[model samples]
Target: MLSHHIQINDHPFHYLGWGDRNDPVILMLHGFPEYSGAWAEVAEDLSRDHHCVAPDQRGYGQSWAPEDVNAYRTGKLVGDMVALIEHLGSRPVMVFGHDWGAAVAYALAISRPDLVSHLIIANGVHPAPFQRALAAGGAQTAASQYIHWLRREGSEEQLAEDDFAKLSSLFGASMDMGWMTPERRAAYLEEWRRPGRMRGMVNWYRASPLRLGQPGEVITDLPEMPTHTLRVRMPHLLIWGERDTALLPEATEGLEDYCDNLTRVTIPNADHWILHQESHRVAAEVRTWLKRL
Candidate 1:
């Protein structure tokens, strides 16, 4: 893999690139507390036919981490992606996002449709459903209690004091055992040990109150761009792990309301960390979709 840093405004974002530069681009965004390396297996496959770029989105790995909470907001995160794409010569790129990265991908497709050609969302739902669930005050709220804890003052300090053992353990516990293998777990631990990385990862939750609370006017309406409209209009694919604890099946209850061209798949006995647990299957599915696209 080829690695480099691209300056997005004031912050320098670290990214890993694979495949030929002349090939069509696919930008992969990883989730919170995880670095760009999470896309290792997937990118290796996709890079054969596409220029795959996986970035340590803002707060993880070698990416720039701004101390201000607002810097981690969804809007700003999406903006950083738009800037990165522009920096890469302003071509329309397909987007693949997992977990929090999926959320950012959704926002990017909606907010800047011209920049994204297609979207592949994994293990996460649209923000509207997430906000409603959080506000409804039941299992959804209970499932998301960790976000509340992360947003609390000094929460980062506490996690830091333990040398991020708790954070690593949390990832291991939340994911399927098969997914968090010794090698995968070690990779995550190595990234977490980087200076100020934990705080930056936690900041994603801290800065997303607007979407996490309620759908504001900005996102309430369908995106004006052709790619941002309802499900039937955009070319899309959704891969879900049925055993996901944080995002229950109910969270996807009304997803069809937005997607135009959509295909949904459920992996049996898998959890939130589907990319790791079923990396080959995920890569095959993505490869098939790209061929169709």
Candidate 2:
């Protein structure tokens, strides 16, 4: 494995890498409250056949984190990745994103299809459908109430209080966290301890364009997103952890309509942290799916 620190879009960026230059590259994007090391296990396995690069995106880990919520906007977040991929030979590579990472991945694929040959998402939702689900005020709306609280002012302070008791609970909420061992938790603590990191992390939620309503409050006025901007034109893979409570399956109910070539898989007994809980199965699924290409 290798550690990288370079200037991307005028800010210092950090990423972890596995395998050598000769291997095909698989760019990994991790979600909220997690860092590039979140891909350590799966990347280690995939390194046997591919070079895996997982970056500590804009606000997390050692990456440049602007406290400005605008920095977390979809275009800025996607632009940061565009710069990274350009730095990595400017070739279309397999892009895998989880949770918040999926937001950027989807935007990259949509705005610059030439940069992504394949799109993979684990326990994440597309903005259009996710917005619709939230507007409907259904199960997903109820499941996503945390977003509202996260968008509130000083929520980061609350998360940082009591030794991050609130943030820790958020991590373990409605999900199985047994996969989080002591060392792993300690690493998370260390990263979260970084100055302004917590605020930057929650900025992702605050900067979100998707609107939410109180439980059962149907919102019909959320503006529609341009269809051309949300379509996934490349071969796509959708992996779901069936037990994920934060994003119910209904959130992705119509994902097929947005992709021409799509494949889906579900890992039982796994939750939002599927990457950690079922890294083996996720890697195997990725390997088997790629074989079909």
Candidate 3:
């Protein structure tokens, strides 16, 4: 793996690259509380056939992080990826995203279909169905009340206290976190402890316009999704760790209607952190899914 700190859109951007430059590229996007190293294992395996570019997104790791909530807007997040693609050949590369990274990837594909060749998401949600589930105020909204906490003022401070015990607990979140070994936790703390990184990371939740319905109450005031433009024309792969508690299967219930070609796979033992819990298995699934092309 090679570490690079390129200036993408004038801000210092960091990414980890694996494999030969001439190989097919896969842009790997990590979600909250994870840095580019989150994909190190999977990328190491896939590097034999494909080059993997895993960026630390905007608010995580060594990447530039502005504390203002507006700076973390969805448009700017998508634009950062667009700029990264432009700087790195801008070809229609395959995109693999997890958690919040999936949000940026989906928006990038929807806004500029010419830039993304294939879309891959692991235990993430598409906005339309995600919003629907949140608005329905069912299991997902109850599960997602954490968003409100993250959005609260000074919550980031609370999360950073006690050597990040709160953040660590949040990361575990009742899921099988056996993958977050001591070494990995130390690495993640190194990233999180960076000045302003915690607030920048939490700003993602604060800046999001998506609304959460009161648990047990169906919401009629939810915003409308642009069904006309959200069509994902590329081949799409949805890899699910069936045990994800934060985002239940209902979050992806109607995802098929938005994609031209969609393939879904489930891993029985893995949860939201499937990329970490089953890295090799996930990599194998990715290779098999790509063979469709």
Candidate 4:
């Protein structure tokens, strides 16, 4: 495996890579509060057959973290992935994303399907389904209260205070932390402490127009999303951790409505951090699923 930095859209982007460059590419995208290293275990398992590349998307880790919230908007976020794929000299590479990264992957697949061969997402929501659940205002709404909290002014300061005590708590929230040992925790902290990185990560939430609605209230003011431009035609796979409290299974409820070739798998034992908590299972599922492609 190798770690390298490249310029994408005039911004420095850092990524971790594995496997021979000549092999088919499998690009991995990490979620919030985590960097490219989040896919270490899965990348190691898949590198034998496929080249795996996981980037610290624009505003995370050692990548360029723009101070403006507008810089983290969906179009800009998807553009970063598009530029990186072009930079890698590959067309329509297999793409995988988790959490916030998954949202970017979805956007990329929708907006620029020519750049994605297959879309694989774990524990991430399709915007439409997520919006429905977020607007419905029940379990998902309560679980997503953190989104509102993160959007507050000075929330980044709180996350960074007390040596990132509040941020550290996010790892073990309603889930097991056995995978996050002292060393792993230290590494995550190192990434989070990068200058301006924490704030940049929070900007993703701030830039999003999705908001948590009151119980029994549905959002009707969502911006128009033209159907022709917002659907996924490439084969798509969704690996879900059934126990993810933050994003319930309901988030995947209507995913197929937007995907032409869709497959969904639920890992009963896993939670939000399934990539780390159940790397073997996740890797095996990915391998088996990709074989059909």
Q: How do these models rank on lDDT, best leading? A: 2, 3, 4, 1
**With candidate 3 superimposed using the best TM-score fit, by how many Å does residue 138's alpha carbon deviate from the native?**
0.7
Evaluate all candidate structures by whole-model CA lDDT and list the values in order: 0.78, 0.92, 0.91, 0.89
lDDT of 3 by residue, 1-293 (tens): 99999997889999999999889889999998888999999999999999899999998999999989999999999999999888788498989999999998899889988999999999988999999998887999899989988999999899999999999999989799988788988999999999999999999999998988668878887766766778889999999999999889999989988889989999999999999899999999999988867
Residue range 111-205, candidate 4, lDDT tens digits:
89889999999999889888878887778887888887899889999999999999888757998778998999889989999999988999999
Q: What residue pairs are clashing in model 1? A: 230-258, 231-258, 231-259, 231-260, 232-259, 232-260, 233-260
TM-score of each: 0.88, 0.98, 0.98, 0.97
Q: What is the lDDT of residue 73 in candidate 3?
A: 97
Candidate 1 at 2: error in angstroms?
1.0
Shift in Å, residue 7, candidate 4: 1.2
Among all windows of 10 consecutive residues in model 1, the one with the lowest summed lDDT is: 214-223
166-237: candidate 2 lDDT, tens digit per residue:
999999997888888999989999999999999999999999889899999999888867666679989999
Screening candidate 4 with a backbone cut-off below 3 angstroms (N, C-alpha, C), the clashing residue pairs are none
| Per-residue lDDT over 1-102 for candidate 1, one digit per residue giving the tens place of the 0 to 100 score | 999887888777899999998998989999966889888888887788889899999888988977778888887899889999998884788899998999
Better of 2 and 4 by lDDT: 2
